[model samples]
Target: MLGSVTLLLERLGARTRHLAGSFVYAVGFGIEVARQLVLFLFGKRPAFRVLTLQILFTGVEALAIVAVLSLSLGAVIIIQGLSLLPQFGQAELTYTVLVVVITRELGPILTAFIVAARSGTAVATELGTMVVNREIEAYIATGVNPIAYLVVPRVIGVTVSVILLNVYFNVFGLAGAFFASRPTAGVALWEYVAQLGAVLQVRDLLGSALKSAVFGVIIALVSCHHGLLVEQASTEIPQQAIRAVSRCFVLLIVVNAGLTLVYYL
Candidate 1:
């Protein structure tokens, strides 16, 4: 019995130490990325091509799917709320619910999930492949800072893409809700718009924007950090990509919940 207890304690200690080391490493990685981002912003020579390509891939290419999903989600909410809320004589509350769910909560979280599944995995896979090919080594040999040349652009691109996508999501979502309400609720477009405007506060928009920015940072940092963890084996590329996506999802949810809790508090 004593031996088993000692063994369990040893295992727990090892895991705790590993988690602590990982946390420290991630923090350092984030600091370095931030420093490089500042330099990239102010430096004479910026990698415009890379940054532009990243945005094109992460944001522009993702619009169709984001639009479809947001529209469907909003329509469903409007239909359900219109059907049920009027029974309780709380029909006017539908707009408030729409603003709260589509704008404040689901908008940012859903966009982050989409970006993570798409761009997060791509970033990790691309970086891991480059690492396996020793391109990172070549960059170092050429006196090019890999973090500045490669990682910084991606971080910025993904962060910008996420924020833009979140806005896009909100717009389409609210628009879909308005249209869906027209047939069922028989409300004019202007009336629906007015109702939404009445319930939607400036703070709701600010909270949403804040959530998007924070989620973007989290996704980029986690993806890049895992991507760089790849070693010589090509097989590790997919493994790292999977890790990046999974970690991004978990972090996004945790951070979103924390932010929502803060907003309520």
Candidate 2:
């Protein structure tokens, strides 16, 4: 029994150390990507071209799903808001609810979730496969900086895509909610617009942009870090991909909560 207890404690300690090291590695990865991004901004046409392709893959390719989700969520929120709030003689608060839920909160979080589900896994799997295939080493032998040439473009693309998709999500969501509300509540479009305009603040938009940007940064770093950890075997690719998605989901949620709290405070 004592032996078993000691063994369990050792395993726990190992896991804790691994977790701490991974966190530190992710932070360093983020910093390196940021440094490369600064360079990409200064006059890197090759990086720009790569960034465009990544944007096409991660952003434009993701529009349909984001649109469908936005429309569905907006309709549901509209239906629920109209159904429940009017009974309390608080029909006017519907716009406020929309502003708070769709604009300030769900828009960015949902966009990040979608990007993570779609692009994050793709990044990890692609990179892990490359690593397993020794393609990363080949790049190094060719004197190419894999982090700058490969990873930075992806990081920039995903960050931009997430932020843009968050904007798109909010726009589609608000518009869908307005149209959906019309059939049931008979609310005037102009009135809904006016109410939203009145209730919405600049800080709400800034907070959302900040949240999405930070979430994008986290997702990219986690995915790339896990992908690069593939030291042996092609079988590890899927495992790394899964780790990337799970870590992104957890980190995004935690960061979202922290940012939301800070916004309110």
Candidate 3:
């Protein structure tokens, strides 16, 4: 029993060290990507082909689900908020509540969930397959940066997609509230909108956008890191994918709390 316990502890220590090394490598990958992006500042530079693939994965594929969810969420919020407002005789507060809920909290959280379901799994599985086939080893031999190729494009794509989708979510969700609202209250479209503008500041939008970007980076980095760790066995790919998702969810919640504290506290 003593020998077995010692061996288990040794394994745990090795795994912790491996994770620490992976994080350092991922950070280095992020810095190098920033340097490469600087070269694209020149208008004449050719566009990145990887970005096109990422757009397909992040934007085009995610649009339908985002649209459906945004519309439904907006209608539900208006109905619920309006229903409760009469308790306090302040129905106009619906606009403020809707804007705050959808813009700041729901938008980033929902988009992060969507990204994890769609792009996150794909990233892990792809990189895992590369490892299984020894393609990653070939890249290492050729001096290719898998992190730059796999992670950077995903980070850029998911961040852009989440922000764009959040904008659309606010637009469509706010609009849907009018149609789904009850007949008696019959709040004017402009009235709710005016109330929203009165309450919500530009800072709210920027803050939400930043949250989405953080989600993108965390998911991309975590997914790619696990994928790169895939072992020789085929079973390891799915295991890594699951680990990546679990890590992303935990990190997202922790990050959201930290950001909220920074802003509100």
Candidate 4:
């Protein structure tokens, strides 16, 4: 029994190391991408078209989903707080709970989750379609870097989108929570907003941005990787896209959990 336990520990260690390595590689990719972006800004390599398209696809497309989620989550959290706070004789703590959860964590994480589900799946499907059509190979044959041409735009797209969406969500969520908690939670709507001024730290927002940024990276990178790995089979396109999104979901949750640990623990 001890031997089996030891073997399991070893396997877990290896898996951890592998994931850590993948994360580092992803970080490196982001760095390289940033460098290229700087060059693009200076007209060294003009890619305004790609960047504009990215903004449209990533930022605009995600607006409705983020708004709906933020409002629903804000309403739900307020309801939960109302239901539970009286039991502890601390109904006013609703303000603390709402600001902490919505502003610091859930706003960003939820935005990323929704973006990953929508944009991430779309990226995989598009790239997979390109692969099935032999376009990636043709691009490579023409000396175009596939990752630069295909992956970087979506990466920048999701990153920008997730960040913008988080901001929007936080704003709307606060409004929703204020409205939702008015009848209960033992605090006036204005009082809750004012209390948030004291409790919501800058670090909370920074942590949220970092978490969402990492999530954006995972969504684009994993999806693109799986998409590019698709062979000639058309059936493999859907399979790889599904696998990519699933892997991205797991990665996003793991990363979010790690960030939450850093903040709370």
Best candidate (score: lDDT) = 1
lDDT of 1 by residue, 1-265 (tens): 9999999999999999999998898888888888999999998446778989999999999988999999989999999999999999998999999999999999999999999999999999999999999999999999998889889989889989999999999999998887888887798988988999999999999999999999888888888898998999999999999999998999999999999999999
Q: List runs of model 3 lying over 4 Å from the truth.
A: 1-19, 22-47, 140-143, 182-184
User: RMSD to native for every prediction?
Assistant: 1.9, 1.8, 2.8, 5.4
TM-score-best of 2 and 3: 2
lDDT of each: 0.92, 0.89, 0.78, 0.79
Q: Give the TM-score ranking, best first.
A: 1, 2, 3, 4
Off by over 4 Å in 4: 1-45, 183-189
lDDT of 2 at 218: 84
Runs of candidate 1 with Cα error greater than 4 angstroms are 1-17
Q: Write the per-residue lDDT of candidate 3 for residues 212-260, one digit (tens) a residue.
A: 8888778777787778779798899999999888888898899988987
Candidate 2, lDDT over the whole model: 0.89
Residue-level lDDT of model 4, residues 110-169, one tens digit each, is 887788778777888888899899898998999876666667777777788888888899
**Model 2 misplacement above 4 A:** 1-13, 43-45
lDDT of 2 by residue, 143-249 (tens): 88889988988888999999999999998998889889888777798988888899899888888898888888888888888899888999999999998999899
lDDT for residue 256 in candidate 3, whole number 0-100: 85
- TM-score, cand. 4: 0.81
